[model samples]
Target: MTLIVDQSTINIQVLFMVNKETKKALIEKGAEIIYLKGFNNTGINEILEAASVPKGSFYYYFKNKEDFGIQLIDHFLVRFLSGADRRLSVTKSSYIERLRVFFDDFLEFFKGNGFKGGCPIANFSLEMSDLNENIRKRLDTAFDQMNNKIALFLEGAVKNGELPEDLDTGLVSNFILNSWEGALLRIKLTRDVYPMKLFYNFVFQDLLNFN
Candidate 1:
């Protein structure tokens, strides 16, 4: 037997599809806004307006503002991690060289953006961690994952004899991540790229102890 779907059912499905698209667009727009202006300063209406989505649509997609914030954090983390992975996996560069490329790319990003803001993770960690447990946990996991990737690189460096075998890779990884975050904060505060350049130089010359 053949079955037919009603026009009303088709219309409802189409509406749902449209609503889902609208929601995705709004979430993406909200993520950009949050990255630039921050979580505390961003307003729901502002996000909706920026996205050009109506209030009904916004609420239909997200339970509340905080829910959207969480989604934004997840999206940002995925994108950031993917970029880092690509940079670290470059075929032509040595493990140590890839690490240096990572630092150079970060500093170049700051310079290219005119140092208006630095790392989104660092920004969100400072702003959202104090007020939201859920966001704090998400940020913490992302940080740990990032540090682990760096540790893996450091381990490769040690195997290649680029880094000393006796060094604690885990501690060195955390130290680099922590120091970079601090350096980004200083660069943002100073509105200058000097801090980033200095940090990059120090990481290569002193921290990594590259010969």
Candidate 2:
């Protein structure tokens, strides 16, 4: 006996994969809007409209708006950390030079974005830190991971004699991240790149100078 499978069943399976892709696209679009507009200011309809995704699709993928926000935070951090890791891993540059290049690259990126949205982690922390515990935890984890990466690079700099042997890598890492976040906020407020330039000059030229 021969058995036949229904074509409709195969189509349903394909549709399932398509749905998953669509859901992820919506989440990414939501992340973009969140960066441009704060969590409280963004509405579901607005996200759906910007994403060009149906309301049913959003509901199918996420449990609610808050769940979408959580996923968005995770998504941004993954991209952010990956980019930083790649930039920091460049072999041709010293650790100090790598750090300067990374800062310059981001300064250009913020300027390209018109200085409208600050750092995503900083944006969420300012808006959701007190309001949402889950998001707060997510931001905390992002900070720890990014700070650790910076410290690891700083330690390498010390070993390479690019930085002082007695330099406190961990402390310097925290200060750098904190200062960058603060500079981003000021840049967004002033709609000027001066704050970023100041930060780069101070951190790279003054604070981290070993020569």
Candidate 3:
């Protein structure tokens, strides 16, 4: 009888793989902490304790809190952009209907959070823009990219004859994004969703109904 052992299989088994779940926990916990405590006020030990991740692991993944913050901003953009792209993409619903649905859903999300944390990008802008140039630059780029996404959809609406051909898509998109961010701040202050609901009503009811 001859017995053969596969050395490659053993080596592969011994190789350590990064724990994706642990890394994700760190990011998610860190984000929540930042929401509760402003970024500058948030301590590294708080995040580590909340995530149950070791200090070495955090340093291995991030150079420092600033690096981690950049990543968090990136994470927020990815999630927000994906939802925006869906609502603004071509669909059977009219452009106005799509806009209504989008804002309504956003209002519902804010309500779910009890109007505690406002937009993450907006929060970062208020907190870190003056203090950290790198973060401020990243935030500026992110806001510009988000504005572009809105402009792209508005352009599509113009092509589909849903909006006026001469309408300034760029300016309109900028106004809409800025208005929403302001509304979010008011919602946090009042602990009410009426401000957001009012924004939706104004935008879709009066602003977009130029026919």
- Alpha-carbon TM-score of each model against the true structure: 0.85, 0.89, 0.87
Name the weakest run of 10 consecutive residues (lDDT summed) in model 1: 75-84
Q: For model 3, what is the error of residue 75's alpha carbon versus the real structure, in angstroms, after optimal superposition?
A: 0.6
For residues 1-211, write the lDDT of model 3, one tens digit per residue. 8988799976765543346667678889998889768899998888989999887678877888899999889888887788877897748877767766766777788889898888888999999999999999999999999898777767877887888999999999898899899999999999987888788777767767765
Ten contiguous residues minimizing lDDT sum, candidate 2:
53-62
What TM-score does structure 3 among the candidates reach? 0.87
Best-fitting candidate, scored by TM-score: 2
Q: In order, what lDDT does every prediction score?
A: 0.83, 0.86, 0.84
Off by over 4 Å in 1: 1-20
Clashing pairs in 3: none
User: 2 or 3: which has the higher TM-score?
Assistant: 2
Per-residue lDDT of 82 in model 3: 88
RMSD of 2: 2.8
lDDT of 2 at 169: 97
Q: Per-residue lDDT of 1-211 in model 1, one digit per residue for the tens?
A: 8998899999999998998888888978888788789989988888899889876667778887778877877787777677668877786777778887877777787788878677887788999899999888988998998898888889988888888889899999899889888889998889887777787778778888765
Better of 1 and 3 by TM-score: 3
lDDT of 2: 0.86
Model 3, position 46, has a per-residue lDDT of 89
